[model samples]
Target: MARLPLTILGSVLFVAGCAGEEAPGPGGPGGPPPIVDANGVVPNYACPGSPGCEKAEGPLLVGVAARPITPVLETWDDLDGDGVRGDGEPFDDVNGNGEWDGVWLAGFAAGRAATEIHDDVWSRVLTFEQGDVSVAMVGLDLVGYFQQDVVKVRLEAAARGLDFDHVVVTSTHTHEGPDTMGMWGAEFGTTGYQEEYIQHIVTQTVDALAEAKASQKAARMKVARGEAPELVNDTRLPEVIDQSIHAAQFIDEAGAPFATLAVWGNHPEALGSDNTQLTSDYVHYLREGLEERYPGTTTVFLSGPLGGLMTTIRITGCPDAAGVETCPQGTFERAEYVGKGAADAAIAALEGSGATIEDSPSLAFRRRSFFIQPTNTGLALLVLTGVLHRDVYSRDKKLIPREQQALLSLTNVKEGDVLIGTELNGVHVGPLAIAMVPGEIYPELWMLKPDGSSYIERPEGGDFSDAMPETPIQAVLPAGVTPVIVNNANDALGYILPQTQFDDAPPYAYGEETEPQYGEENSVGYTMGPTLTKEFAAMYGR
Candidate 1:
């Protein structure tokens, strides 16, 4: 397959001042010079060096911490079934005093209120430090987290004197969690996100970071990869599934497990849409299974490139918690089955073929902020109507003040005039290279054969048929290194697929009789796939 060149120059910045060059003074001669991209914007870096660059001094230290972030439910029952909360709507008289009170469950559809708490959701953090540089990876059990909230977590951490070089806040994309992104409210255009609940999440996240930082201890690392395709189902045509599970296990001096960071590409929605109970879905079990396997060890689960709608929905014949062979969808049994199955796969890979890194492996990272043009009218309406609370940027990457957002309309704004500001992060810890994507990426964008060919073929009728496949993320990294592509890392802009496979307009691709596939409807726009792939490849100077 032909690869697309790095054409999105403004989105990527090259590292200046190579190794052996005189380190500039603090604030003058010895300090690092400002590195700018093609657009003349300064990019953030963990160290003053190239991509995956590191400056190690002391032994590697690792710590893990978690805090419950379940929201206190205050929801109004939709009596009229109009998908809107109104004055006449009845409240849960049994649970409360006939007043509206419940939490909006995100993912499948709107107005899905949480009836009960099956399991608690969490804000988990894994901290790493090898020298002066420190990085924090926060995993939240939610459908999606906006970049605006991520910024709040960073600022709060800084205020508490717990500053890290880079912080990657990711969501597990649990369909049963509270709607933090504001889309899945009681109605179609209404916002389900509660300001107080979002604040609670932010506070808990920062607390987890602080706790993790204080608990850091000297540790070693082990990296491994396993395959569990049977646990994942591709709901879209031209099926491509990322069955690989990447794990990084940290060990203390006594060889006791400190924490295990598992990365996989499957939506945590095994409980399905009709269920109203609030839970982390399969993620709760995935973490529980791992922690039980290694007592006293914490496990952090990060969702990977599950954009082509990789899920456990409709997957049958898996053993349930009671050892039953037949597990059905939308049941707690199915969720447990898939979660434990994934946990078992990771354990087998870690114990059987895990590779331990040398002591005190260097840690470094790079973060770039770029703009994605919005093409979906529904998404734009959500932003304009104040249903989606996020900062919008102009073509020049300037923030369009929220006050002025009301005045903007589809007729006034051109196709590329309005943009969404998001981030792409890359981290290197010894031989492991981690790509932190801002949304659910398609598996084809991350997985590639050794010869740089995709395992899946492009469909026949895409919007961009002549478009070349952007270089797969794994292909851009150094050879012989373990790669972990984390999706929904900093923000959730919906599905990120290849531009060549973007089929928003009919005649639909994959021979659909009517409308285009499901992925495009939730996506920000067609440019997401190309923009992310190009920027990611350029981040590594591919």
Candidate 2:
């Protein structure tokens, strides 16, 4: 899960111990591996006439997994046989009858990669520094990026010698996963058949980071949070979201929770959008329920920022309970009673959130880069007013005229290009912040609380701000501090706009009020949730 910040930290959200460094204790396997040493990955080498400061020596920890992998490339028609598919090169199998349709399917792709899920696993995490600052916690999987493409994956983890203070790239928004994205959203992973499944997903993330770095060890690092709210649900609408669970166990020496980081939000898509089968949904029921209730832990799922969010479902149509296909638009026992209540609320947030350990002599992880402002009108102008293209999200799912999305935004992004939006404001291993905002947001701006004047402060309860309470943690730290609103995860724009509803007002008003009525797609819209939190604390300076 890598960029777009719609929401779904994981589900939509992993370590060990000592000697040759054998970890297992903490109520885990047989028990006893938590020693600690060799911590390296330094690289910040300051540039552009540097005054001087090029840090990077060791004690780093990096992880990655960029989800969305539903590969089904090739289907054809266009030049408008009127059979449908936006019109033209529509991918090209042209009814030779190979199988993808006159291609009513509309979307299909597979190009983009920089995968490295676990090459040397914790990539770097052995911290020792006590004063100034040298924290650690690096993991990525991405989703939304029209700016800084996750700062080119954090300058490729600081050109390989990382120096993070919370580089949490958690995403599993598997709308069948793949297509790190190339404009017109949700087109689904491209191909040469994804070149051997993206080289077997970067060789199983570099062989699970060389088997978790030949299996590192040490221990202690626990933190628990609660509120499973019957397995998180809200799936956006004026419904505002954020189902708080925020765990991060990581223990050894006798404590427990070998490695866990749950994080939450909604919309692993629960397996629909026409699924072609190639899943991670229910994330193997959260890695077989955290390996049958803590049997030598190692679970990592970080999804949130579910832009317009979803999942208080319980199965209203298809893909219920991980089957991958359930349709009818609404019904399947409410999606299998909300996918068996988000897998029994992620196994009661891992057997009731008491998982302790963060031993901290001095643990820190730093990453900084803030500057976002591109949206003559979001979605590069709805794809330059083509009204949200990619075949209008595959055949008219809805919207096609800002003058026809301005002719695909006059040919995609130019006239002063660049929209920054990078948010990962981390701290206290909680009260998190992971923005990527672009479109679908308006679920009451996720908590809308701006007062002192400047926009949405209207809270007394009667309309304006204060609705998003499905479970939005609230961590929001960057400048001063205070953050938490976990949605789908990296870059999934799609919806979000709460400045009193825009588009020349009248019909709904300010920031374009509860969108979905113009064409009727359902699920809910308009934009800007996470309650605009001081306009994202003044767009990330906090």
- Number of the predicted model whose lDDT against the real structure is largest: 1
TM-score attained by model 1 = 0.87
* lDDT score for residue 235 of model 2: 40
Please list the C-alpha lDDT of all candidates, in the order they appear: 0.75, 0.35
Model 2 spans with C-alpha error above 4 angstroms:
1-58, 63-72, 75-98, 101-486, 490-542
Tell me the deviation in Å of residue 363 in model 1.
0.8
Q: Tell me, what's the RMSD of every candidate?
A: 7.3, 23.3
After superposing all C-alphas onto the true structure, candidate 1 shows an RMSD in angstroms of 7.3
lDDT of 2 by residue, 138-170 (tens): 223323222123233333433344333223333
Candidate 1: tens digits of C-alpha lDDT, residues 280-323: 98888889988999999999999987878798865664765885
Q: Best candidate, TM-score-wise? A: 1
